[model samples]
Target chain A: MSRFLSVLLHGFWKDLPPFRLVLGLCPALAVTASANNGLGMGMSVTFVLIFSNLVISLLRNVIPNKVRIASYIVIIATLVVIVEMILQAYFFGLSQQLGIYIPLIVVNCIILGRAEAFASRNTPFLSAVDGLSIGLGFTMSLTVVGSIREMLGAGTWFGMSLASAEFEPFAFMIKAPGAFICLGLLLGLMNAFSHWRGENVIQK
Target chain B: MDLVLLAISAIFVNNILLAQYLGNCPFCGVSKKLSTSLGMGAAVIFVATLASIFTWLVYYYLLEPLGLKYMQTLVFILIIASLVQFVEIFLKKFSKPLYNALGIYLPLITTNCAVMGIALLNIKHEFGFWEMVVFSISSAAGFTLAIILFASIRERLFISHVPSFMKGTAIALVTAGIMSLSFMGFSGMVN
Candidate 1:
């Protein structure tokens, strides 16, 4: 039980997908223009990650060692297609917002990284927990980054205007460059905080 | 003229790395040194173009006729993985020096989103064979250009006084942001 618990919590902070592990950054940067988009993208990734981890863990024994990577890609791609269809059916606006990123999730690295590292070696139940934890961690990071960008850029939080009408949005905060700079500075700040607390920062 | 504009736009305005955010792992991971970045760039130029061509062919000749368009993500990835394997073996047999140059980077290209992203974009934009060829080469060229410039900047950063916490990827990412900002200036040149 403790092992499961530890596995679950690690992804939250210790191995936070985008910040700590530094995996799945392409989606982290691309679809985070608005808080809604971030949440949508994060949820989609979470769904895919959970199922892919579960399936990969279950098949770990059966899949040939030589072709495990290819098998994993096939599984991840199928899950992404399912998610893409669901989003198109129910969340058309967001699907449009995310654009190619939805399909690009196949190469996000986080899914593949987890499948290769944790899932392949762990029990199915434990792997599922790992998936949930890591997926949520990724979701949390995207949401935080998205909230920051959306609030600063559009003076809104999840589409709710938080800033006064007089506030002029810093339009640059929502652009391509802003994604890099914002995530960079946030990462640096996290490192500084980790250092002050005497925890060894995960150097990516 | 339109083809030239497409090339410029793909290379500059829609840079696969800076603007589109594809293939960022190598953008950050393999960009620390000039020599390795050059090698990776060349490998990408070679493989991405080939992958694009083959994927385009497979899409038009096989998937579209069979109405397997939904399988694009899966098919494209499998094609790229196998294609990378074939290229690796082909290079090892034919050109020892070329293989030596791109040996390490070839395997990594299978997972690089830029290769897959370019394949998907070629289809999305509905480019014909000639247009796909132009777009693929220029897009890879754009990737090469960005990484080379980034490597030069990162080399300089090694000597600069970066704060301790921001020493590695953090600082590199911040620099990439500035570079991306500069690249945004080209957006006006197209569209």
Candidate 2:
């Protein structure tokens, strides 16, 4: 049970995807311009991560050694399509909001990174736990960045218009450059917190 | 005239790294050194051009004809994976100097989304064959340009004193943000 819990917690702070490992930068930056977008993108990645981790864990033995990476890509791509279609079918508006990042998720190093690193080696149950933890961590990072971007850029938190009429929104916060800057600052803050906790010090 | 504009626009206006944000893994990872950046840029240009052209054929001839267009993500990734694998072997065997230059990065481009992104955009925009080739090449040129410029800045950064927490990827990203802001200047230069 402790092992399972560790696998789950591992993704949250220690092995966090965007902030710690910096694995999934593309979507971490792209869809994270708004709080709503951040949550939606994170959830979609979580869904794909859980299922792909499970399937890859199950097929670990049967897949040929040489072709494993290829096999993994195919499996991941198929799952991304399913998630894309489902999102399109039910959440039409979000499908538009997220846009190409959905299909682009297929190439997200985080998904493939986990499949190769954790899922390929561990048991199915453990793999699922790992996937959930990492997905949550990723989701948290995206939301934090998105929320900050939204609040500063648009004077809204999840589109609520929190700021008064006199408040001047920093419009650049939602632009492409703003995404990079917001994420960079947030990442630095996370690192400092971790450092205060006496964890690993960030080098280049 | 429009072709020239499209080429210029893709390279600078919608530049792959700063503007579109694809292939950033390599952008951030390899841009620490100008040499590696040049090598990666060259390799990506080669693979992205060929992969886009080949994937175009596959998409139009194979996938769309059979109504398997939904399988594009899967198919294009598979194609890119194989394409990079083939290029790795071909470069290693034929050109020793070139192989060493692109040694590590060749395999990395397989998963780089920029190559696949360009292929998808080609189909998405429905470029003609010539237009497609030109777009692929120029987009890659754009990628190369961004990465090389980043590498030079990162070289200076290596000597500068950065905040500890913001050291590494954090500072790199912040630097890229500033660069991206600069690139936004080109937004209306063409259209």
Q: Pick the candidate with the highest lDDT.
A: 1
Cα lDDT, model 1, residue A4: 74
Off by over 4 Å in 2: none
Which pairs of residues clash in candidate 2, taking residues 3 or more apart in a chain or in different chains? none
DockQ of each: 0.78, 0.79
- Evaluate model 1 with DockQ and give the value: 0.78
Q: Given candidate 1, what's the lDDT at residue A81?
A: 94
How many pairs collide in each candidate, listed in order?
A: 0, 0
What is the CA-based DockQ of model 2?
A: 0.79
* Deviation in Å, model 1, residue A59 alpha carbon: 1.0
Tens digit of lDDT per residue, candidate 1, span A1-204? 889789989999999979999878899999999989999999999999999999999999999999999999999999999998999899999998998899999989999999999999999989988999999999999999999999999899999989988999998989989999999999999999999999998475
For model 1, residues B1-191, the per-residue Cα lDDT tens digits are: 48999999999999999999888899989999999999999999999999999999999999999999988988998999999999999999999999999999998898899999999999999999999999999999999999999999999999989889998888888899999999999999999
Cα lDDT tens digits for candidate 2, B12-114 = 8998778778888888888999988999999999999999989999999999999998888888888899988988889899998988888789888987888
Compute fnat per model. 0.68, 0.74
lDDT of residue B37 for candidate 1: 98
CA shift at A101, candidate 1, in angstroms? 0.6
